[model samples]
Target chain A: MENFTPGASFLGGVLIGLSASLLLLCNGKIAGISGILGGLLRPVRDDTLWRVFFIAGLLAGGAILRLVSPQVFDIALTRSGEVFLLAGLLVGFGARLGSGCTSGHGVCGISRLSPRSLLATLIFMTAGIVTVYIVNTFFGGAL
Target chain B: MSTLVTSFLAGMLFAVGLGLSGMTQPAKVVGFLDLTGRWDPSLACVMLGAIAVHAPAYRLIRRRSAPIFAAAFAIPTRRDFDLRLVGGAALFGIGWGLGGFCPGPAITSLPSGHTAVLLFVPAMVAGMYLHTLVEGLQVRRSGIVHPETVSRSPTLPPSPALQYRHDA
Candidate 1:
C-alpha cells in the first residue's frame, strides 16, 4: 500500500489510453508493445520502419524520464537475474502465442470488448497473481 | 512521415504513461500482482484509467470509415477460443508475475542501461523466436502446410478478419 499512488496511476493510465487511442485513431493500429516488437523480430518489409520509429520513441521517452525525474525510474527489481531471464522467456513466448500483453489484451483489446482479449487478460492476470503467491510465500521470494 | 510522427509520439506517450503509472518499477507491478501481500492497487487504477479512456475512444473511432493515416481499422477479428490464447496467456502471466516486466515497460527501459532490462529484453526476444521455432516444429510434425490457418499475419496492415496480435 505504501507504493500505491492512485492519482498518478490513474493519470498514467489515462495517458496510456490516450496513446493507444491515438495510435488506433491516426495510424489504424493497435498499440500492442509485444506485437510491435515481435513483428520487428521477424522483420517484415513494409512494417519495420514504423515499428523502429515507435520503438525509438519509447527509448527516447525512457531516456528523457531518466534525465528529468530519475526518482520515478527507480524501479526495484528484487528478483535474481535468473528469475528475470526465465520470466522474460515466458513473457516472450506467452505474448506471441497469446497475441498480446497488458497493452493489447488488457487495454486496447478490452476496450474493444474482444472476447479473446478478455480471456487473455483474465488468464495472464490470474497467472501473475498465482506466480506472485508462489514466489513470495512458497519460494520465500527467491524465485 | 505522418505515420512515423504519430507512431513515435504514441510510443513516447505510452512510455510516459508507464513511467507515471509506476509500471516501470518491478516492485510496483509485483505489488499489484501480490494479492496476498501488501497489495498496491496502482496497476489496477492504471488499467481502469486506460480502459475508461480507450473504450469510449474505440466507440467513437469505430464510427469512422477509415483512419487518417491508414485505409481502415487494423483490428483483430478472430472469434475462436483456442489453446494458444489461453495457454500463451497463462504462461505470460507467470513470466509477468515472476519478472515484473511486461514487454512494453521492458522495451521502454532498455535505454536506461539497467543490468536487469538488458538481460531480460534479449531473453524475451530469444523466447519469442523460440516459440516461433516450436510452433514451426509442431506444424511440421502435424504435416500441414497451413500454419496459423485461423489467424492472419499480425505484422501486416490489420484487416477486419485478421487475428488479434496480443502484445502488451
Candidate 2:
C-alpha cells in the first residue's frame, strides 16, 4: 500500500535483468552475486580479477547512489547488532551451502526455468515468510 | 581487459537497478515480505520485471554457439535436488527475513557505512570462509582431492569421472 512503487520497481528490475543479460552474453557467466563474491574467498587463476573488479564496481555504484539518491540507503530496521551478526552468518553460510542466493537462484536461475532454482526459490521464500511471521508475532514485531 | 571492464559496468548497472527498485532500503524489502501485515507488492513487481526481460533474453543469448567474450556459457546444469540445496536455502531465508538484506543489496549498501552493513558483510565473509574450510576438511577426511586442486596440479592426470562431474 502506502509504500508500493510498482513503476520504479519494474524499471529497476528491468535494469537488473539487463545487467544480468549483459554479463551472460558477454562473459558467459551467471550474474550471481554470491557466487561472484564467494569465488573470491579462494582465488582461482584468471577468475580472480573479474570478481574483484565486479565487487569494486558494486561498491563504487553504491557510492554513486549515496551521492545521487541518498534515500535509497535509508535504514529502518530496529534489529540489534547481535541479530545482524547472526543474520549475516546465516546468509553467508546458507548462500554458499545452497550454492546460490537471491540473484543466482531467484532472479537468474528462475528466469532460465531451472527446476532446482525454482524449488530453491520456493523453499527460501517460504522460509523467509515463516521467519518474518515468527519474528513479528512472537518477538513483539520489533523487527 | 574487456571482460573486466564489462564486469565492472555490469556490476554498476546491477547496483543501480537494486537501488532504483527500492531494494537497498531494508524497510521496503521487509514491507514486501510482510504479507499478512500491510503487504507491499512492489518487490513482486521487481521480480516480474526482471524475469520478463531476462527469461527471453536468456533464451535468445543461449541460442548462440558461444558468448561474445568467452569460449562457452558457464551456466549451472545440475538437475538433481538434494538436502544441501534445501537446507542452505532455508537457512538463507531465515537470515534474509531477520536482516532484510541479501548478498547483493548488502554489498551495494556498503557505501552507506552503516553499522549493520559493516557488521553483516564481514560476518557473511567469515561464514563463506568457514564453508571453504569445512569443505576442505571434508575432502581431506574423505581422502578425495578437490577437483579444482586436482585440475590445477599438472602432475595428476585428470580423472574421467571428475571431468564428467565438472561438465554436468
Candidate 3:
C-alpha cells in the first residue's frame, strides 16, 4: 500500500520487543501501558515510582520523536471530539476490565504463549476490525 | 534509583519503537484494521518483529531465579477464560477501531500536543477510574476484598499470587 513502511515497522517492533525484554529482565515488569497507568490510578507503596518514571519516560520519548522525526507524528484523519471522547472512555474501561491492552496481551503475553493474552488479542483485533467495517458501511467510513 | 532509571529508559525505548513503527499514527492503525479496504500490513510486521525478539528473550529471562532488580518476576498467572476478559477486550477493540488509539499510542502521542490526544487520554483515564469505582462497589457489596485492592495496600507485600491476579 502507499502508506506501508515494513522496514520501519519491523525496526520499531524490534525496539518494542527489546524494551519489553529489558523491563522484564531488570524490573520484572511487563511493560503493559494500560496496566502501568492503571496501577498509577490506584498506587501501592514501593510500586509507584517505577510506574511514574516509566510514564515520564514515555512522555520524554514522545518529545524526542517530535524533535527527531516530526513527520511521523502527522495526523491523517480527523474525527469529531465526541468520537474521541467515546473511544477513550471505552478503551480505558475495557483495558482495565480486560487486564491488558496491545502491549501486555498482544506482544508480551503472546510472546510468553499465554492463552489468556492470546484470546484477548484475538477478541480485540476482531472487534476492532468489525467496528471499522460497521463504520465504513453504515457510518460512511468516517467517525 | 536504578529501578526508576531503568523503567524510564525502557519506557523511552518503547515509545521510540511505537513512533518508528508508525503506531502513533492513527490512520496507519486504522488502515491495518481495515482489511477490506486498501490494507496496510505494517502493523502486522510490527507485531511479528516484536514477538520474534520478545518470545525467545522472555524464555531466556525467565530462566533466572529472579529479575536483576526485583525479588521475583511479576507475571500474570491466571488461566481461566472468563467473561470479564472477553467482554473488556471486545469493548476495547471497538474503542480502538473508532478512535485508532489504544492506550500506548494515545499516551505516546501526548507529547505531540494534538487536540485529539489531549481529548482522548483524559477520557481514557476517567474511564479507568470509573472501572475502579464500580469494582470497589462490587467488592463492597460482595463483602469480599478484590485482589487488586489487596495488592495495592501497604500492609501486604506483593506476592506472586496477588501480582498474578492483577499484573496484567
Q: Which candidate should be chosen as best, given lDDT against the real structure?
A: 3
Model 2: colliding residue pairs: none
The pairs that clash in candidate 1 are: A99-B165, A99-B166, A100-B166, A100-B167, A101-B166, A101-B167, A101-B168
> What CAPRI grade goes to candidate 2?
medium
lDDT of 1 by residue, B33-142 (tens): 99989999999999999999999999999899999998777788776788989999999999999999999999888878888898889999998998767766766686
What is the docking quality class of candidate 3? high
Best by TM-score: 3
User: Which consecutive 10 residues in model 2 chain A have the weakest lDDT in total?
Assistant: A39-48
lDDT of 2: 0.86
Q: Which of candidates 1 and 2 is the stronger one according to DockQ? A: 1
Per-residue lDDT for A14 in model 2?
Answer: 97
lDDT of 1 at A62: 91
What stretches of model 2 exceed 4 Å from their correct place? B150-168
Clash total of candidate 3: 0
Decreasing TM-score order of the candidates: 3, 2, 1
Looking at candidate 2 chain B, the ten consecutive residues that score lowest on lDDT are B159-168
lDDT of 3 by residue, A25-66 (tens): 999989899999998887777888999999998999999999
Q: What TM-score does chain B alone reach in each candidate, compared with the true chain B?
A: 0.84, 0.88, 0.90
